[model samples]
Target: MANFSTNEFKAGLKIMLDGEPCNILENEYVKPGKGQAFNRVKIRKLISGKVLEKTFKSGDTFEGADVLDTTLAYLYNDGEFWHFMNNETFEQIAADAKAVGENVKWLVENDDCTITLWNGNPISVTPPNFVELEITETDPGLKGDTAGTGGKPATLTTGAVVRVPLFVQIGEVIKVDTRTGDYVSRVQK
Candidate 1:
């Protein structure tokens, strides 16, 4: 396995620590007035979603994680696990709730998703940044209430609730930013 020196530490860099995979969330180089420079890093355990702060000396090193991210299409879920398929190979994998995490709310049928595999098994799944989903449920829009920024909670077809403008009605497709869980815009279709 290859090793990464402190100089290589940066956000989104995956490495192995304590025999587990962790992604570097943040890394800052701090040089003291009289001592060696060290890297202050914030890391998140990939499997557990645990965030940890650690410091490593300038010469410190860690092995690169055996993690692979692949784009897959979302299949249906069976309550216990979510299924995804690699279109290139037609291979499929089922990710449990832990791996899917909060991304479940953004999943739409046949949408492309990024799934990380560790040791040939799924460890994480990420939906697209933007998704257009039809509103399945929401309160009726007011006749002439388009003045303020006030909005109502709309439940999307994927079951994700987002605050949308009062003009948005049920069955209308709207764009949503999955990264922030915010409503982007209304889609004509």
Candidate 2:
């Protein structure tokens, strides 16, 4: 319903393009010595997760998209859908496997997650930046290897595998960076 001029284009801005909601990933302006200037925008489609680039004249505009981000506590997956609830309102929503994507591996019961909604429906789910999950399987820890000089692959409780220090062992809880899937440190207790 709202219009956004090219001047307002910036990373993270959401607007409608070709009848679909798209989030602006990058916006670059170009001006020539002899002609008019234009803007190049890189955007990602909300529903399909596709990225594309478009160019617009300096004064062009686009319709604003109805996008919102909210924090919700994850409930559980019913094989077909993953559920989440708003702690304050107790409102619940379900996201299909497409919406969950690869983030399903980082979800843990009762954990808070960032959910992106478009037109009152979820389009994407983001897990916490860092999570502490127990190592369900891995090779036995090497004796006197507390320094973590060498690393080994560890399977987390959520089924995601990551390389951890040699000192890490199965059944130990460790903090991991969800964004990079890197081992951060061991969780005390």
Expressed as tens digits, the lDDT of each residue in 1-189 for candidate 2 is 689999999899999998889999999999998999999889999878899989999889899999999999999999999999999999999999888999999999999999999898898999999989999999997767875476899999899999998888888999999999999999989
Query: Which residue pairs clash within candidate 2?
Result: none
After TM-score superposition, the amount by which residue 20's alpha carbon in candidate 1 deviates from its true location, in angstroms, is: 2.6
- Model 1, 1-189: lDDT tens digits are 699998898788899998889999999889989988988999999998899999989879999998988999999999899999988899999999989999999998899999999988999999999999999999998857773677999999878999999988999999999999999998996
Query: What stretches of model 2 exceed 4 Å from their correct place?
Result: none
lDDT of 2 at 46: 84
* TM-score leader: 2
